[model samples]
Target: MRNRTLILGVTALAVAVTGLAAPSFAARDKMTPEQRAERMIKRLDTNSDSKVSLDELQAHMTANFKAFDTNGDGQISADEMQAKRQAFRDARKAWQEAKSKDGKERDAALAQLKDARPAMVPGMRPKAFKRVDADGNGSLSAAEVASASEKMFKRRDKNGDGVIDAADFTKKI
Candidate 1:
């Protein structure tokens, strides 16, 4: 009789855990790569023209720079950049902590996280800005932003279609 009760308790615990984890699994499953790319394109294509132009990209990047410039100083200082990096790390740690408790699920989640790491992060922003800072001005000007945007557009528009659209994100597989 004791063994039967213990087995029921364990089964109940497993069911509760599984129930709690179901939503996260479902959410992750629903976010396909195409959906993610479309979301990004929508966000970057500010004019809703179904394509991302250099002007749109530059505007977005400039806005991001302003956001990171906590002091409204028109430049991102090392301290501001460090704060951004810390925030990113904290968020990533929280995400990892919220991942599945089951070993297999946890491993899969970690693998997915590794695969989905962004090509650019706040920590890399300073270096990226330096690359964009033409004339060694130590700061990004509007012209530099436009130039950088043009370069980025060229790189992302793999087919050289003059604009970034859904085709740029398509995989050949």
Candidate 2:
């Protein structure tokens, strides 16, 4: 039972990193699940010949895990997790502060705060993502889809070259 609990906890952490690093949740809405799977295959298929080798999978997972292991430790503890979540929240707040009031964009921007609110508090299940869930299942939850109509203003740092597109910056300004 202890081992199972550890495994589930590890899996949940993997899911969080994988989910956050995943193609923007907003983009997933435009394509069907099948299409998204295909895209993932292409993205993960690093060799470009046409398939995902187990090595590639391991490399991807390791890279993502390392990304969160900010302290260079071999493990991701609750503190590390909280640090990551805080980083996301900080970015969200900065972006929110930059937006204007009285428009669809503002409404959309505010929803990120709404989506991440549950995480902000000590213990509250998020409501914004649930509001968008179509099947009422325990899937599809993240501030990534904060607002369905919100436009994507930033280029995703898909390549992970230490920059979001060209700028090595975030919404800090």
Candidate 3:
């Protein structure tokens, strides 16, 4: 009779734990690719114009570059970039460590981290810096940034509509 009571208590605890963890899994599964793209376009469409223009792209890139510069030096050095990368890696490692006790949770955290990795880090490498520097100045100027942004804007404007909207990222159903 005592064994039966202990088994029931353990089963109840298991069910409670499972219920508590289910919502996070469900929320992550609910966002479709189209929804995610729409959210991104909405975010980047700073003027609420429902589309992203070359000017807007350049503005966004300028802001991001300033953020990466960290010391207001008007240039992102190797040390600054390395610091950003290290911060990202450390955060990812801490997240993984926090989930170490639960295999499913750890896997989910890892997958999310992988998906959220920055898209621009590789473009900040030495070769890319040389390409963006344009005049071999060893640093990027506002003009150089605008030029790079123009190239990105052209590439992202897939239909050549002169602006990037959800259509640029979404596929036809």
Best by lDDT: 3
Off by over 4 Å in 2: 1-30, 96-173
Candidate 3 error regions (>4 Å)? 1-36, 99-122, 170-173
RMSD of each: 10.2, 23.8, 8.7
Report lDDT (Cα) of residue 79, candidate 2: 58
What's model 1's lDDT at 13? 100
Write down the lDDT of every candidate, Cα atoms only.
0.70, 0.49, 0.74
lDDT for model 1: 0.70
TM-score for candidate 2, please give it. Answer: 0.38
Clashes of 3: 0
lDDT of 3 by residue, 3-78 (tens): 9999999999999999999998998979977787687677678899889987877777777777667788777666
Which candidate achieves the best TM-score against the true structure?
Answer: 3
The alpha-carbon deviation from the true structure for residue 30 of candidate 3, after best TM-score superposition, in angstroms, is 11
Give per-residue CA lDDT, model 1, range 8-112, as digits (tens): 999999999999999988988698777887887888888888888877777787766665666886765556666766766665674588585777766766665
lDDT of 3 at 153: 83
Model 2: which residue pairs collide?
Answer: none
